[model samples]
Target chain A: MELKKPAMAGTTESSDVMITLRPNPEGGIVIDLKSDVKALFGDAIEKTILEVLKEFQVENALVNVVDKGALDFVIRARMQCAVCRAAEIQFDWGKEDAHGK
Target chain B: MANELMRTSLYAGGTSPVKMIQAGFYNEDCLVYDLEDSVSAGEKDAARFLVYNAVKYQRPAGKYILIRVNGIYSQELDEDLEAAVRAQPDAIRIPKVEYAEEVKRIDEKVTAIEQKAGLPVGGVKFWCNIESYLGVLSAQQIATASPRVVAMALGAEDFTASMSAQRTKPGWEIFYARNAILMACRAAGISAQDAVFSDINDPEGLKKDLEMTRALGFDGKTCVHPRQIDAVNGCFTPSPKEIRNAQRVLEALEEAARNHTGVCVLDGGMVDKPMELRARTTLAKAAAAGIKVGGVK
Candidate 1:
């Protein structure tokens, strides 16, 4: 899905990740991640976000992630919400897997 | 049958990941992931996604989980039901339920979703929130509206607001609604959950209110804060004296059965069917609370 507008989801609360998605029409997904645990779980967090974007077919977007040590499911949920909002569509539970498997 | 010891059903805001992650660690019997009043209007979608993933993937074990959706008339109800049904919590609590028709509609919608998702059609259950005078009057019908209805809770704040009455600490204003909901639940053989105490800091007030809640025969109580769970669970647990009496009642029945007599007597009183049933329920409650009752499982 193509991004129609810039959108963001989640808060910077403890055990949460705030994600900002902006439309990047030129192509290629760009990620800017800020996390205290970047040395340990940074790659894992980036992989989770990229997987969600791939599942939604969102190829061209600028992803900004501020991680507060969120779990995998929390990260996936926030990413899904951000993608849906940026694409200007309602969430379709049938098309999306909440479990992120 | 539902969990026998559902003394406390604690609400965890769906938008708060920290609360959701920590909610299961509490001793509350049920964890309610709330997507309704606790969430802001713009964050409804976010809350739904968060709750869906929380329940579907990271669900906590051994606790009855419920997801409170928006009201039936709200625009978010459809999508909320879609995600909630697929997420597969123990039940979906519909807020501000006032009529049987609304439940029937939700029941049908849930059935369709379950079928589409290939889940058991009746595996999902309902917990209706009766928050209006119309809801109070239609309690019986709502309790019996669908076979999936496992419990009905009184939303005292909204009920009092609907009646144009002030809500006081004593809670006399909601007395009738409480009894109405309890009677409907009893008649329908489902759990009757009481409203939240709403005074998190006042344990004394919560205890006093819980006295009435237990006296009114509510099966459980909704809790807004984690600190209230222990109090609610303690209030609902069977006392030792009650447990001993239940044991005596069962022993008396056993003795009568061994003697080949139809009449069972205990402590100068007849142990009738209703009394025996209450005794068994008490013993069952004790057992669930991890209290050992002699000669009873």
Candidate 2:
């Protein structure tokens, strides 16, 4: 299910997450995301993780991904983070602390 | 790869040890079964449970038990790993280790499971199959991240597809990936295993390929069929001469210990260090082969 759909019962917007990815020169990829809540629904989360992997172009590279919360914006940010990590380019996306700049 | 460290390992290809046993492969020592591939799509859960139950009992002949879980990135991977944690086979095989983070994720998952299961943690080992192109790329980081990792393996069939080198032998086409992975495993102090030779009928071909793999730095090869085990065993097992050398090393070391000398010289150099390890491992392997050694057989 799309993270942005109306919050299902017992669902919290804060529980959703979005990921960004980028290239890393270490012959791998990296990921960044926002997961305000730690409600890891196991299998459900795997669907999204796999999707993000598609963009990383998983060739000769290492990947690092971080999670925040459920936000479409967060997903984009995660992708961006992955790119930076894969490229060995570091960017701050901590929502404000020298990141998100 | 003949110069590569040789270890004997077996595969079940996602089947239960029982199935392997029923098929006559499990009774042989040094055999292992996979919990991830080969099983029908629907039977994974049941097969996993069966494997777990089987682990509660001793495997056929002190066989080295290994469970290959689905790629950790899969939707069911976490669950599969969790099931295995409680089962605690000899080792947990992480399929498609595409990056360092995946290995870290596996390490963390295994740790949490060990703690939650109330099992004294830290004994389960990792067997990472560097199958995909991405897996090969991150092979170094992945192999070294987990302290529990005992070895890394190649998944040529899938990797061939990924690299579009399908059905081609001259693996040197992916020579860089192969060398890099082998080097990584060596740097990490773990065994590097090779995947199965699919053509079961071509025993000669299989033997030839293994010679290359052994030369390339693989400790052992994974087998898809039971018939292939003999060749794998033959390739990896310590030869009579090597065993004799190991026994010699052990005896020399023992005499030094008996003399109360912390260490002694051997082969015209400091034989203290390598001699001890080689001696013990030799003893262990000899024991595995039913040969008795001083104080350990």
Candidate 3:
């Protein structure tokens, strides 16, 4: 789905990542990540964001992440919220099932 | 999670990943991942997704997990139900429940979601929050509305507001509602959970309130902080003296049975059916609390 607008989810709390998604018609999923654990888990965080984007079928977007040592599930949840808010779509359980599949 | 010890159902904010990750490590018997009052209106969607994923991927074991959804009439109810049912927590707690019809409605919706998601029908249980005068009056009907209703909690803050009564530490204002809810739960054969004490700083006050709660026959209490879990659990657990007395009563009954006699006596007093039942319940509670009670099964 194409992003309709810019939206953000999560916070700068101790174990959360604030994810911001903007519509990027030609950027092809550009990520700007600022995290204290960049040297250790940067690739894993970016990969989680990309996986959520793929699950939501968003091929082009600018993903801005402010990480505070969040886990993989937290990242996935935040990314899903951001994508759903940006795409102006209600969260569908069927889509979640498809993602699980 | 039905029939499990739910001495303290602690709330973890649905949007806070820190609390959600650490909630299970606490000694609380139940973890209530709250998506209603703790979450703001704008963050409702985020909280739903957060709680869903938390329960789906990182569910904590050995604790009763409950996802407290929004009110039955709210716009967020549908999405909350959809995500909550799919996540498959032990139960979904419906806040601000006022009528039996509301419970039935939510039960039907949950059944549909379970079917669509290929989950077992009636697998999802419910905990209703009776927080109003109307709800208290209809507590019996609400408790008996659906077979999946395993427990009902009294939301004192809302209930007092509904009654226009002053909230006090002594909790005289909620006395009637407490008994009403307790009786209803007893009549319906479901667990009755008491309201939160709200004052986390005063451990003495909490202890007093828990005394009243246990005396009123409440099975458990809602806790806002993890520090209160041990106190609540201890208050609900059967004491060593009670356990010993229960064992003696059971032993007397067993001896009578072996002697082919119907008379059972303990401590110079005849033990009746009610005493036997209370003793059994005491032993059961002791066992559930992980206390070693000898000479009793």
Candidate 4:
């Protein structure tokens, strides 16, 4: 269960944002997201998405999201599962490792 | 079975001191305030008095009271039942019901008590705690015992101890037990409640378990803390999308029935009886949440 810890995902809120995150062998990560998601979701979806990613300990990753009338519940469920898959949910991406560790 | 909204119940009587803090705090769902644990063996009499008084007239809206008396065969349990029948709670919760005969045995007592009280002979339902080795093995028989039986459950801690399972949280290894109880309950036309997560402080863990329980079609869950009420409410409440999905399914099904078709397709799939049962549950959640899910039958 050894996952290389070199990945990153940046957050964006414009409509048409694509969220994608994965491992890059070169030691960093790529984050790609379209900008239109914010327009589609407004405040609730944005808050849920951010909370889901960080709660599942997704750090050092790339993300791309395409919003098509998705709500906060949908975003949260999807992002939580995706982050679980990406990070194995094995680390504390929320705070400094030692304090959380 | 009711063909309309039935009140799904959440259980809250613990073997230790536990209580729900307010009215329908778990979305004002059904509450079974425990007399067994809240009162000491010395104070069991007083505890039953308090619970009976609560049940008699003061139960809040959206809350129904059931007394989790001591296990059905205990001497203390016999005393608790006598007091409970005098006050007349909704259902008698018999812990660790391992056999069909246990239902018959408890039924005899309930019948005698109901007869003596002359309380309109409601038959006061009998259900099982399918929580031990024998309980799981004989779930189907126990569930089918009598028409008065309404549900089945696996007391996770006791069942886990019987299985020698090693998990930090309560439900980690008991998903099979849960499903077994659920299947047998459905087969016998009854509801199933998932066991309590004993750690009251772990709201996240509680919420996660209750969410999974709801996803798996459990009508309700047992709880040991009032703080867990909000978590259970959040986990079990239907989102707008779920209600909309239920609405769509109901409409499609009604159309198909008009055409004399047994199945209807919704969201690129066929909506059949099983899916209808699930949709009905979603509808119940919407109803419980005070959101109108139209076309519910």
Reference-based lDDT, each prediction: 0.92, 0.60, 0.92, 0.61
lDDT of candidate 4 vs native? 0.61
Q: Residue A49's C-alpha lDDT in candidate 4?
A: 62
Best by TM-score: 3
Tens digits of per-residue lDDT, candidate 2, A15-89, equal 223223333445543333224343564334444455544443344323323343433322332333334433443
Could you tell me which 10 consecutive residues in candidate 4 chain B have the lowest summed lDDT? B14-23
Q: Deviation in angstroms for B107 in model 4?
A: 0.8
Please rank every candidate by TM-score, starting with the best.
3, 1, 4, 2
For model 2, state the Cα shift of residue B33 in Å.
Answer: 3.1
Instruction: Write candidate 1's Cα lDDT for A28-80 as tens digits.
Output: 99999999999999999999999989888888999999999999999999999
Q: Retained native contacts per candidate, as fractions?
A: 0.85, 0.00, 0.79, 0.00
Instruction: State residue B19's C-alpha deviation in candidate 2, in Å.
Output: 2.2
TM-score of chain A of 4: 0.49
lDDT of 2 by residue, B185-211 (tens): 988988878776788798888878887
Tens-digit per-residue lDDT, B12-84, candidate 3: 9998999999998999888999999999999999999899999988888888999999988899999999999
List the lowest-lDDT window of 10 residues for candidate 1 chain B.
Answer: B1-10
Q: B1-297, model 1: which lDDT tens digit per residue?
A: 344467789999989999999998999998999999999999999999999999988998888999999989999999999999988889999999999999999999999999888789999899999999999999999999999999999999999999999999999999999999999999999999999999799999999999999888898999989999999999889998898888888889889998999888888889999988989988877888888777753
The whole-model C-alpha lDDT of candidate 1 against the native structure comes to 0.92
lDDT by residue for model 4 (B85-194), tens: 65566567778888899887777777776776665565566546776877988898999887768877778888988889865564658888888898998898897777
